[model samples]
Target: MLMALSAPALAHPHSFIDMQTTLVMQQKNLLALKMVWTMDEITSADLLYDAGSAGAGSEIWKKLAAEVMARVMAQHYFTNVYRDGKPLRYMRLPSEYQLSRNGNKAVLEFVIPLAQPAPLAGKPIIFSTYDPSYFVDMTYKSDRALHLPAEATPACALSLFTPKPNASMQAYALSLDKADAPPEEMDLGQQFAQKVTLQCQ
Candidate 1:
């Protein structure tokens, strides 16, 4: 009998930031999202998000937020209702709202607000992302490593900039695939229960 050891990569859930998407009625005509990354310095960042027909921060922001948040939070997460970089409220898992850019090439070193599920806390979320209209590839490296076709690899992954006044949000859709699965899922519920038990001990 032959024993197979390694599993395929695509079989695992891709990791993207588990963020709560929401909207803000700020004076500026912009759209934005907030989420913490394992990297303290986001050398580059951008939202390959949608810009509905209206373009940029048009009536499209709210509409897209609602749509995207649903996809992200389907696994059980919530959106944070914020205003001008401060916490204003908390929307249930899968909240939607407007987005705005406060800075560029920003470096953020904050703690995650919520504790991850039993085995997910203190781990990293690998954001394997891609979009047709907008691209946000910060590394700007070849796609061979990611097992993607050269053409499929995004050229503008790091195109971090605020949306224009009359710009419509990118019409691209968002997909979230958890990166940490096999190694973690081995004993997920059990590991989580052990963590709780250890905490009480």
Candidate 2:
């Protein structure tokens, strides 16, 4: 459930939350991840997702959202090769998926397709999120040492989101190319923790 909204912060009524790594696995050598996203009081809520119903403003929102998601995903991998660049190629989803909502919480799920199938042996996969605002906040990050059995195949990946604060705003701006600052140099995990601490205080 959402806490009582403070009037001052209400100017940015919508917030985006980063979901921690919940599960990672390999099926027949392929790697899959699942993620979720949510928001607050965002207008034309239909435009709130990477792909969804759009308002007259929906096209603007869609473009901004795509850029942000692409950038954040790149930062997590410690590369600027965004979406379809080398090292890691961004797998395109249908772009019409809906965010899962329950009361005040919504889940934005992101799936990343690995460049190669997970090796039969264990390997390290680094996952991270960064807010591209004045502070370049990081919401969550973790390094998963994955053990892939011989049978692992390419499977779906997932990540989750809740409505924290400034998440979607940052994403929205990136989608629109109106971000206030370049992404920070600090590692995504440290940057995100610092941003949250600063905001919560």
Candidate 3:
């Protein structure tokens, strides 16, 4: 009976990343977000190899950085920000960004600003990061990866939540093809995303 069943092959993630984010606030008002993504050794190797072949100080690296930023911009930085349950909008492209090779890994850093700074006088804010297609695995390297500067929000508190998908959902995510967009009802990445909450007085 087992021989008679055919199971479709799934495309799993080939790249891994350790991510960190910092909430940027000014005078108790959320101003922007700072993010750092460090790619795993294998993935970084390919990028470094390409850069080397392009020659020393080649513009290829910068071009690659721009291309990468463009893709993430299309996906809204793979980020979701909410204040009091209302979604916040991105004011513009990343205010600052750079991509560089660090030893055996590649690191990307950028800052994304909000359309209008949200006052956190006494409100709660939620922020999450996930790739909707689940083509790449993004995880926080540690609890300390998420930061809030005390000077900007003296009375604010921060909490981090890292959720893992259950067996069924994990199986579903693993079976998805990279080329196919996940169905509307299936948010594979969201199931395993890291959530950051900020509460201020």
TM agreement with the true structure for every prediction: 0.25, 0.41, 0.84
- Which stretch of 10 consecutive residues in model 1 shows the poorest summed lDDT? 192-201
lDDT of 3 at 169: 81
- Per-candidate Cα RMSD to the true structure, in Å, reads 19.3, 11.7, 6.6
Worst 10 residues of 3 by lDDT: 1-10
* lDDT string, candidate 1, 1-201, tens digits: 000111123322112221221111122211223332221112123232233234446565545445444543542322232233344322344222343323332122112222222211122212222211111111212222122223323421111121122222111112212233223233222211100000000
Candidate 3 to truth, TM:
0.84
lDDT of 2 by residue, 5-113 (tens): 1112322222445443333344433344444444433321443443443343355554654554654444452222212122434354422333344443434445555
Candidate 3, residue 77: the lDDT equals 85
Q: How well does model 3 score by local distance difference test?
A: 0.76
List ranges where model 3 is wrong by over 4 Å.
1-11, 53-58, 176-184
The list of candidate 2 runs beyond 4 A from truth reads 1-14, 22-24, 27-30, 40-88, 94-96, 134-190, 193-201
**Backbone clashes in model 3, listed as residue pairs:** none
What TM-score does prediction 2 earn? 0.41
